[model samples]
Target chain A: MEIFSNLADGFAVALTAQHLLLALLGCFLGTLMGALPGLGPANGVAILIPIAFTLGLGPVASLILLTSVYYGAMYGGRISSILLNIPGDEPAMMTCLDGHPMALHGKAGEALAISGIASFIGSFFATWGLVLIAPQLVKVALLFGPAEYFALFTMAFATLGGVTASNQAKSAFAAALGLGIAMIGSDSQTGSERFTFGHIHLYDGIDFLIAIVGLFAISEVLIFIEHHQGGAAAKSSAKIGKLIPDFCIFKRSIGTLVRSTIIGFLSGVLPGAGASLGSFLSYSVEKNTLDRENKTFGKGDPRGVIAPECGNNAAAGGALVPMLSLGVPGSGTTAVLLAVLLQLNITPGPLLFRNNPDIVWGLIAALFIANFMLLALNLPMVGLFTRVLLIPTRILMPVVAMISFVGIYGLTGSTFDVMLMVGFGFGGWLLRKLGVPLVPVILGILLGNEMEVNLRRALQISDGDWSIMVGSPLAIGIWAIAIAGFVLPIFFGKKVKNQMHADHSEVEMEEVIEGGD
Target chain B: MSDRIFGFFGLALSAFYFWATSIIPDSFMIDVVGPRAFPYIVGTVLAICALYILLRPDAEPDWPNLMNFIEIVFATAVMFLYAWTLSKVGFVIATVFATSYLTWRLGSKPLGSLITGIATSAGIYVVFHLILGLSLAKGPLGF
Candidate 1:
């Protein structure tokens, strides 16, 4: 009854014309942006935050628009992943495994429709789960303190080794580097310049959006110059089959969907776990469940596609749980949300639910609306996103380049930003060459500030006792799970791969981490 | 391995970073955490990665077309100039040159390239400045 009243009030806020229009506009732009290569959702959201701020949007309206865009991007990412074999981000990497092959087999439409419905199921189910499980999850999360946080951070650091495409030590080194960068400007506790090197820009910490754009967006352009021309959607045909997925096919994978949602949502709720993980775990879980069937999982298996799509989308929502209820972001995108909340002077956490019930509940309601709207938007438009290839690369590339430059300039009237974009582009090109995953860098930067704050705060409470991190059972359990997530890979990654192959013939194209994508 | 590229660049960059860090005056409240510690770590990592790459040239992927390198560098130069010129020379002239170079490289017809360069710049001007209400600089056309 209480929940019903809250949701009714939320409907009042969400149903307003202003919020609805913002949601529509956000979804429209997000799909369009995701349709484009070289610009993913995080950068899309980051670049548009200035515009959102300029519009003087209230917290609910701003979150509604931004979150809608997020859902749209998830929907749109499959367009490129299916038709062009370009995963928009790490989460979409799995989609391309089966989706691109399906496209190759003239089942592009089926793949898109399947993945689309799967995304809707994943997102819709997860949103419902959000309303139901969030308060309970928050109740559990409240028991964590700095000792627990420190332990969790350490486990996050450990898990990152498995999370990345490279050696764990290198990923850890990157984390340390990101932490070092976060320690720039001035140490909040010590009141001293750290790495400013006499440049005033160094006085302020690195703007995560700037670094992200540099790393993911600009870097993508630089690398695209090398291999982008050869295969840019060569002769991919569309499916003329049923636009909606057959329920019989879905019947086989409902377990994958439910299990994946649980796994994905849980991963998303954890401080450092992410959508890619949600999808990966979901795929693995589905594979284990189907082991007896001799199901060939990655050879355009519907379950293969279903698991990740469901997991990633559910993870997207689960990621928001921590961001909303705990003020801690479980992933890079949510961390960006945190930064936006901070900029707007909106405190996100348990108090947010209490103080601004409308914003919290309304934003939740908008996500439900977005999930449905994206399904409608995507079903009618899969062909349109694929048709983008009809625009000659000649015109498209230059226009995209011009728009990126113009966007940088318009957002910040500074020449340095453009140069910074180039520098990050170069660095990104090198990282790509080396096969290090780019998502981790963005994840690191997004969480970098929070990790630092939590570390310091933990120490303050424990009076510098490192043992405080796992002092509570909940914290200890998180630490154990995190350690298992990292260590299980060393012993079990190969075994899991072989078991997977023994059961399901075609192995998942070990996600091309470096350059091939 | 052309350590000349890695070695010279690595040593030079780290030297600069080290020198920059060395200048931070020692304080009475010195603790385990300091500004210099992080940079030194990154410099060390960069030096290590550079060394590994330099030592093992065989590990690098089969190089793409050699001419692609030249193209990439040239494009980077074009973008650098675009950044440099956008504010001073104004967006129009800078954009025209950037678009023309990018289009020609991407295999567009010259006439189409020229039209696109001018049209995109104009479209951007109207969309960003006129429509969005952010101030974009007017070129000599002064619209």
Candidate 2:
């Protein structure tokens, strides 16, 4: 009953004309960003962060806009998968398996409609799950002391590789690099300069936004330039026959949608498991259970298309739970969102719910509204979005570059930050070539200061005793989970990554054969 | 192998970071854990990770061909120059040149690139500066 009343209040805030408009715009822009290859939700939100700030949107409005983008991107990721056989993002990889096949069969519109519906269902239920579960998680989080927080942050880093990273060493190295970057500027507690190197700008440290825009946006431009591949424009030859799927197709996928939503939502709640794992797990599980003997699972199977789409979107919603409740981002995009929250001076965690109920509830309500908007917007606008795929990389990359420069300059009015951003961009490009993951680096930067502060606080409480980290059973349990999360991935991660690649190549091979015919 | 080179680079970075951490003067009001303590831990962890990479190298990564590599360098140089000149030459002028060059390199015709560059610069100026009322870098010719 209290939850209902709180939600009603949230609706009151979210229904305001300004917030609603922001949500609509966010969804529109997010879909556009997601339709383009190499610009996933992370980069989409990253690019818009400056704009949100420049507009001076209040905390709730800004969150509503960005989270709408996050959800919209998840919905939009399926467009390229169906049309071009290229996933707009990692989580959409599974969608490409069945989606492109459907597209090849001239059921492209149907595939797009089904995916949009699935994404809506996944997000809708997952947001409810977030509403129910986050408060309980916050109850658990309320028991945490400095030591527990340190342990939790450590666990986040350890598991950030999830089941995707091919090499944990590279992930660890990236995390350390991010922490190194975080160590720049004057020490907050002591006010002593650590890595400023006598530069005045260095005193304030590298803004995480600059690092994010640099690593995700600028590095992307460099990669585009290096590939020199003409824009990944949609093939005019591919046909989209119908806008609506048959009722039977929807009925057939209902079970898969429910199961995938559950799997994705749970995967999202787990720190660092995120949408990629959710999609992978949901797709694999559905295949093993429902399509074990079908022989048509990947041959334009609607269920195959539905499973991963629902799973990833649900996971996207699920990622928000831990972020809002525990101050631990569940995915890369959520990590970037955490940076946004920190920039707004609104630290997320248990207290965020207590201190800023309006923000938390308003954001939750806006997510609900945004999901409906995305479904309505996406279904009618599939052709519009597919047209986005036709946008050439040649024209798009320069716009991206200009936005980064102008946006960053507008935010801090600092030319030095712009220069520093370019440096990070180059460094990020080099790191990517070396097979280092960027998400953990971003996470490390976001969590580094908090992790250090907690550790120092814990030590201070225990009079510099190291044993206090595992003093409580809760802390010990968290540490054990952290250790397990780090070690277990090494054994199983390779198999999962290999399986994904194998499936990818298999699909590509099939496409080539079909093209030949 | 590239992995080995990356490992050595990481090791050097960690060593330098550690030395830098060591040189931080202790603050008078420092707590039980000083500002340098966390950095020291981070540096040590980085050193260990670098050592692990060095000891167990992965398969060699695919390197870009020389021509592709040169193109990448050129693009990077253009970016650095754009950053350098952004404040000096103003956002509109700098953006026009940067976007034009980048678009051209990305395979657009020169005229198309120039049009794209100009259109993008003006479009952004109107949206961000004029409409949104956000301040941007100004040139000698002002608006």
Candidate 3:
């Protein structure tokens, strides 16, 4: 099969000494970034993109490093949840329910070990899921004509704008805005200047690297300043508790791994639910199934730790499926990666299989290696990553800042880029304050061009018959999904929000009467 | 009134999209669709989202950081100066000055930031100019 030979070629690329070293370095750095609280895969990868670009690595090498960091963070996120009751990212939040309590019970070691094994189970299976399903999905993708692509990308944008999080719709908006800004220089279709504003530099459109760094990295720094006067301090704790688990612990929770992996992976593939939902679903499922054990699920149970850890890790892998095959990111992080891939001029979809086999296979292989490496390093290195929490914000920030500056210059040695970074960074800060999620903006920007090109192409074919979108099943299916993606969230999310508010109000009323008496 | 205004804008965008959707030039090679189709859809959706925001304004825009805005403007201004004077002032002076201003804004010590900025500019200049042997454009400001 072509897949095997292509995979072999990817292995040859991945196995080279330079790439091997890069992978290891990537895995190490990825864990370091992942361990940081509140900074998940998206922020972590976005922050260090400049470093990869500065180092002058090709696209393949860059993707491998970034992907490794993504998996590494999933590994490190568990330790924080277990030890500190602080999930490093959203996916790890469910682990905090049982994991932190278990640590207090002196089963921190067991909790951690179980989480490690569960994570390995989740990621391994998810990677294989990608391997088995990617080609088939690619086959399905080939059926999409431009009209279908147009409809699908619009749906992706709609989902991005609608979902993600409550904190920053502007982030997504900003991303799409940035994409539209990038489209300004020369029109790909008409070769006309749309928004050059008389600047010759505008002719080339905006660079994706510059926009990403300015928005994600620089804005992050401004945010840090607003929150911390002196930034996060470094903690280098050298204590490693229990690092390994015996068979008894393994036997007790193997079912949790299987169930959670499936739950996590499936929920993860959905556009809006994301990992938090996945982990929560997994935790409840484990509870319903094992309620008769006379054991508390959330109070310090190993299964509690296992379910979320497995679910979240598997979900990270599952989120990639839609992004890779359909060129639609189910979540914010994948949207950013989608932007990166498009910038490198790789058009993702069924044709990606026929072309760019090296990139597709190489990234896939790197992810497989990243999972195993994460498990191996996590147990022995928990103490070290925990210590990373204490790194002085003063020191880490300056170094990162300098790396960003140097990295931007590496691309065409452009001084003009510094201006763009600072501008977007400030805009990003403003957008954040407005409660706009930056992800959708980027998504809109990314899909804007795709949507535009497809619209033009589709119109040319249909001679301006507006019914082209509704006429075909493939287009109609995408349209239906797009509508569902938008409408379903509002219906269900509103019900949940109202119910939560109702419960809170009842609790408040009860407390008020008692206090008055 | 603000809500109504945003809603009207949303409606306007959607209408504009429908009108503009008709203007895409025909490329008859592919009989399925043309370039105008997606924009027509997105323009329409953006209008819909705009309407959603107008009808249900969950969150409004927040305030910008004043200090960051100042820093951003100064940073952009410095780049403009560099581009205009790159040949005149020479790469080293222009770069050093820009770097100094930025580092100072970034919270470096006045002296340290300036020294380091100059040092960084000079260091890069050395690598790019002397070692790599790229020639700096010598204009009014001589090297």
Candidate 4:
């Protein structure tokens, strides 16, 4: 009864005309960004951060808008995968296994509709799961002390190698680099400058928005430039025969939708296991469980498309649980969201629900509305989004560049910060070329100060005793998990990486053969 | 291999970072753990990771050809120039130059690039400055 009343109050806040408009705008923009091949949720949210600030939207409205984009991007990622044999993002990679085949068979519209419906089912229930789980997780987070919190951050960093990065050593190095960047400003504790290098602008440290936009959006443009020769445009000439799927296919996929949703939701809830893992795991599980003979999996099976689509969307919803409750992001996009919350001076954690109940409940309520909006919007709008794929990179990249420069300048009014953003962009490009994952770096920047503060606090409490780090059982357990999270990845990570590569090549090979024919 | 080169670069960075941390002036009201402690740990971890990378380098990476490399550098230079001249030339003028060059470099015809540049700058100005009421840098001609 209390939960229902809370949700009702939340719905009241979310139903305002302004908030509803923002949600609608976010879903639309998010889908457009998601349909684009390279601009996934993180870059989409990052590029829009300054606009949100300039609009002076309240914390609740800003969050509602951004999170809607997050969910919508997850929904839109399937468009390119089904029609063009190219994934809109990494999580959509699995969709190509069967989605392209469906397109080839003139079921492009059916595939899109089915994926949209499955995504709706997955995200709808997962939002409910977030509603049920986040508050309880907050209760548990309430018990954490400084030492335990420090250990928890370490656990977050340790697990980054498992799911995101290709190499653990490189991931650790990127994290260290991010922490080093965080140390450039005046010390929060002592007001003493650490690495300002005699520059006044360095005193305030690098802004998170500048860093994120630089690393994601700016570097993306640079990459587009370098790879411009090949012109990776989608040429989807497949006829979309029907807008709706056959009833029997939907009936057959009912069990698959439920099973994949559960798998994906759990994957998202786990630290560092994001939508990519969710999609991969759900698709593989469905394939192995149903098609052990491997006859129907990569050969245009509806279940194959349904499984990954459902899983990734569910995982996208599930990723919000840890971020809302514990203040640790569940994925790269959520990390950007966490930065937005911090920028608004609203720290998300156990105290958030108590202190900012309206923002919290309103966001959750808006998520429900956004889900319905996406389901309604995506089905009719598939044709429009497929057209988004046709825009040339020559035009798109310049606009992206203009947005980054203009947005950064607008936010700070400092050409100096703009230059600093460009510097970060170059560094991000270099690191990316070296095969270092950028997410860990962003995570490190976001969480480094907090991690350091917790450690210092714990040490201060114990009178400079290092043993206090392991004094609590909870801390000990978390450290153990951190170690396991780091080490287990080294042993098992190669298999997963190889499998992904294999899948990628298989899809590319099929494309090559199709092109030759 | 590229990894080994990156590893060496990381080592140098970590050494410099550690040296910088050591030279941070001690604050009068510093606690038992100073600001240098966390940075020191970060530098140390970086060194270890870099050392591991140096010892076990990955295979040689696929480097872009010379022309592509030069083009990337040119794009970076254009961005840097745009940032440097943003205030002096104003958002509109500076954006027009940068957007035009970038679009042309990305394979647009000169006329097309010019049109895109003008259109993009005008569009952003209308939306961001006029509608949103955000302040933009004005050139000598002023708004």
- Docking class of predicted structure 3: incorrect
For B28-61, candidate 2 gives per-residue lDDT tens digits of 7778999899999999989999999988999888
DockQ of each: 0.32, 0.82, 0.17, 0.76
| lDDT (10s digit) by residue, model 1, range A1-517 | 6777888788889998989989988887787767666556775676666567555578788889988988787777777777777776667776776677676666777888888888899888788777877776667656767566556555655665444333443354455445555656766555567667778866777766566656655665666666546234435444535566677888877787788878877877665567877877787788778865744666677777888888888888887886777665656567567667765778776668778889888988999888888887788777777676445656666676676666666666778778777776677676566544555565566555566566667666777666776677878887798777666665655564454334232323433432255
Per-prediction TM-score, please? 0.82, 0.99, 0.80, 0.98
Error of 2 at A467 (Å): 0.5
| Ranked candidates (lDDT, high to low) | 2, 4, 1, 3
In order, the first chain's TM-score in every candidate is 0.83, 0.98, 0.89, 0.97
Strongest candidate by TM-score: 2
Write one digit per residue (lDDT tens) for candidate 4, span A1-517.
6777889989999999999999999999999888888899999999988889877888899999999999999999999899988788889999989888888888899999989998999999999999999989999999999999999998888886655456799888888988888888889988889898778998988888899999999999888888883243665444677887787887887889889999999999998798999999999999889999978888788888899999999999899999989998867888999988988989889999889888889999999999999998999878888887878889988899889887788889898999888888888888888888888789888888889999999999999999999998989999998888888878888888789778767867877898799
The Cα error of candidate 1 at residue A84, in Å, is 5.2
By how many angstroms RMSD does model 4 differ from the true structure?
A: 1.4
Docking quality level of the chain pair in candidate 2:
high
Please give the range of 10 consecutive residues that has the lowest summed lDDT in model 4 chain A: A229-238
| Least well predicted 10-residue stretch by lDDT in candidate 3 chain A | A164-173
Per-residue alpha-carbon lDDT of candidate 2 for residues A1-517, written as tens digits (9 for 90 to 100) = 7888889999999999999999999999999988889899999999889878987889899999999999989988889988888899889999998998998888998998888888889999999999999899999999999999999998888988887668888889999999888988888788889887798998888899999999999999989888886565675635777888787877877789889999999999897588988988899899999878858767888888999999999999999998989998867899999988998999999899999999999999999999999989999877888877777899998899889888898898888888889888988999999899998899888888889999999999999999999999999999999888888878998898899888878889977898898
lDDT of 3 by residue, A1-517 (tens): 8767777777876776766667787778877776776466777777666556555578888888887877777777777777766677767877887787677667777777788888888888988787777788888888888789878876775565334234222233344344445455656775555456678877787776677667777677666555442334334452445767766866877788889999988877776666666776787788789865746865677887888888988888888888888888877677767866775678777777678888888888888777877877777766677778775453344344444555565554666776677677777776666556677666666666776777777776778876776778989988888777766655565554454345234434544564588
Give lDDT for model 2: 0.89
Q: What is the lDDT of residue A30 in candidate 3?
A: 73
Model 1, which residues run further than 4 Å from truth? A1-4, A35-39, A54-56, A81-89, A96-111, A161-164, A228-256, A270-273, A284-305, A327-348, A354-356, A458-517, B1-65, B137-143
DockQ for candidate 4, C-alpha atoms: 0.76
- The positional error of residue A38 in candidate 2, measured at the CA in angstroms, is 1.1
